[model samples]
Target: MRPDLELVANLIQTDARVLDLGCGDGELLHNLQQHKSVIGYGLDKDAENIGLCLAKGVNVIEQDLDEGLGNFQDDSFDMVIMTETIQSVHNPLLLLQEMLRVGRECVVTFPNFGHWRCRLHLAASGKMPVSAHLPHRWYDTPNIHLCTFNDFEALCAHLNMLILQRRVVNRHHNERSLINLAPNLFGSYGFYHLGRTT
Candidate 1:
């Protein structure tokens, strides 16, 4: 499992209902089910991923995230999760609202665009940076609204979302002591557990 997913799995309650958005091949969901005893459902637009989910005996639905999530009723799940896919969304804030609407809490992880490496690369080269975490050319990348850790926190505040927990780690997914001091600059990825403010 990816280090971020490992941390996410630890956040889930045993026997909780989980809805995973852009759930790739259901790897995280599968892990959650087996270890945490959670009931998991996955949503992915890719047909190949949907097939993989089925083969793994995981329940999955085919849906485009950009089209919105009207099918799920409010507070239908204990937790919703979206990992490594937020930057690709057309309207991340709207999607986050929907996630909180349908689930009591949500876990989201994304690459931190404000990391020193990315900033230095752009400053020195006058072009977008492509690193191990963000391994894509600017034109062909799926990421549309890349953001920093600060940017995401501000958005959550603006949306009245309460961050329950946060973790910042390097590209290897290891937490460094220094990340606590300057997360936006040193953290390569950010994982957040958030809920709607009461």
Candidate 2:
């Protein structure tokens, strides 16, 4: 399992209802079901991922995230999850709102564009950074709305979303002391657990 997914799995309670958005291959969902006894569903647009999910005997749905989550009832799930997919979405704020509407809480992860490497790359080369976490060329990148940790926090505040937990880690998905002091500069990626404010 990816380190971020492993962390997310730890956050979920046993027997909780989970809906994973952009759930590639349903790996996290499968692990949750096997270990935590959670009721999980995955939504992915990729045909290959759908086949893999079925092979694993995981409940999966074929759907595009850009279309919105109108199918699920409000507060039907204990949690919703979208990993590294926020930047690729067209309207991230709206998507977050939808996630909160359908589930009590949501877990999100994304590459932090404000890290020192990206900033230094821009300063030195005058171009977008191509680091281990963000390996794509600017033209071919799926990250259309790349943002920093601060930016995402601001967005959450704008929506009045309560941040339950936030973790910033390096490219290896390991936490470091420096990252704790200045996450915007040292953190390579960020994982957030959020819920709508009551």
Candidate 3:
């Protein structure tokens, strides 16, 4: 399993129902089912990923997150997760609202566009940054709305969501302690647990 995914799995509660949005290959869902005995569902737009998920015995739905998850009722699952896919979404706020509407909590992770290395590349090279954490050239990248840690936090506040927990990961995907100090400048990626404020 990828180190970032391992960290995500570790944060999820045992026996909770989980819905993984953009769950490529369903590795995290399958792991949760096996280790925690949790019920899991996955949503991905990729047909190949859906097939792969089914082969791994994971329950998966082939759907685009931008269409909204109308099939699921309010608070239908314990958690809804969107990892490494928010930047690609057309309407992130709407997607986030839908996640909150359908689940008790939401887990989201995304590359920090404002990371120091990205900044350095932009300043020195005058070109789009590409690194292990964000390994995509400008024209070919899937990321459309790259965001910083502070930008996401402000959006959460605007959406009336409470940040239950926040963590940062380094380039090697190891957890970092001083993430809150200057997450945009120091962190390579951001992880957040969110819930309704009221």
Comparing 2 and 3 on lDDT, the stronger one: 2
Worst 10 residues of 1 by lDDT: 2-11
* Best candidate (score: TM-score): 2
Identify the runs in model 2 with alpha carbons over 4 angstroms from their true place: none
Tens digits of per-residue lDDT for model 2 on 39-149? 999999999999999999899999999999999999999999999999999989889999999999999999999999999999999988999889999999988999999
Compare the candidates by lDDT and give the number of the best one.
Answer: 2
Runs of candidate 3 with Cα error greater than 4 angstroms are 177-180
**How well does candidate 1 score on lDDT at residue 44?**
97
Per-model TM against the reference: 0.97, 0.98, 0.94
Model 2 residue 151 lDDT? 99
Over the stretch 1-198, how does candidate 3's per-residue lDDT look in tens digits? 988888789878899999999999999999999999888899999989998999999999998888888999999999999999999999998999999999999999999999999999999999999988889898998898899998999999999999999888777877666655777898998889999988
| Winner of 1 and 3 under lDDT | 1
Q: Clashes in model 3: which pairs? A: none
Question: Candidate 1: which stretches are off by over 4 Å?
Answer: none
Clashing pairs in 1: none
Q: How well is each residue in 8-48 modelled by candidate 1, as lDDT tens digits? A: 88888999999999999999998888888898889999999
